[model samples]
Target: MKEYKISLPICENDIDTLQAGDYVYLTGTVYTARDAAHLRMYEAAGRGEDLPFDIKGSVIYYLGPSPAREGQVIGSAGPTTSGRMDKYTPTLLDMGLKAMIGKGRRSPEVIESMKKNGAVYFAAVGGAGALLSKCIKSAEVIAYDDLGTEAIRKLYVEDLPVITVIDREGNNLYDSV
Candidate 1:
């Protein structure tokens, strides 16, 4: 498998070049939103309101990091279970979300959406929150602040590692072994 060092706001060409089992180091901005933030975003969409941010071509990280320790950018910023976002995945993908970073396998319909939309799913090692935090250079709440740690955060990351779990062609690394 090939490896890539990519910047975000990923385009079709970027997703096309990746495949299941390949590694990636993402440098650029990525958004963080766990279950609660997703629910809010879904509701906001249903209400015909503006989304908190432009999602097109963006990568969403399924993370709800702990409060940053004093004098730090973030703390223990690890991926959460992606299954939690299954119901919301296709809709977001349809709206131009190009990639998702989280832990665990995705559902069939989600993979289909990835195929039809030319998106990708990536897996970051769970339980490596402390180490993961080191890659996040900055973190700021963009919306839903009342949820505290569950709030949507915009993170600027450098060399944040992930494995392509499912490629646009529906190849799944999780089952490859």
Candidate 2:
């Protein structure tokens, strides 16, 4: 496996060099979205409505952070099960979403969409919420704030660690393990 340092609003060239099992340290913007947020986005797209954020070249992390404590930018922010968003995944990929960060396996259809779209999938280590939050430099709810922790947050992150669970070519690290 290789290790790479990449910035967000990722382009196809940046993702082309990656392989499943490669380690990545991402710096730049990433939007947080869980199941509720995904459903909303998907529905919005279906209606040909504008999304809260631009979908092109964006990375979406499936996270629901807890309320922050004093002096903290964010609270424990960990990945949620990715499979829950499988139904919405393909459409998002088609809409120009560059990558996704979460845990667990993805459906075959989603993997195929990733291959077709030249996107990648990264996995944040589960149960490492506190450690992960340290990478987030700033966070603010951009939409769906009523969902609280499930809100879509615009976050600025630096050196946020993740592994390439599935690369653009439909290569899956989980398959070999």
Residues 107-166, candidate 2: write the lDDT tens digits.
999999999989999999999999999999999999998998999999999999999999
Instruction: Quote each prediction's TM-score.
Output: 0.98, 0.98
- Local accuracy by lDDT, each model: 0.92, 0.95
Error of 2 at 47 (Å): 0.7
| Clash pairs, model 2 backbone | none
Q: Would you give me the overall lDDT of model 2?
A: 0.95
Looking at model 2, report the run of 10 residues with the lowest lDDT sum. 7-16
How many residue pairs clash (N, CA or C atoms closer than 3 angstroms) in each of the candidate models, in the order given?
Answer: 0, 0
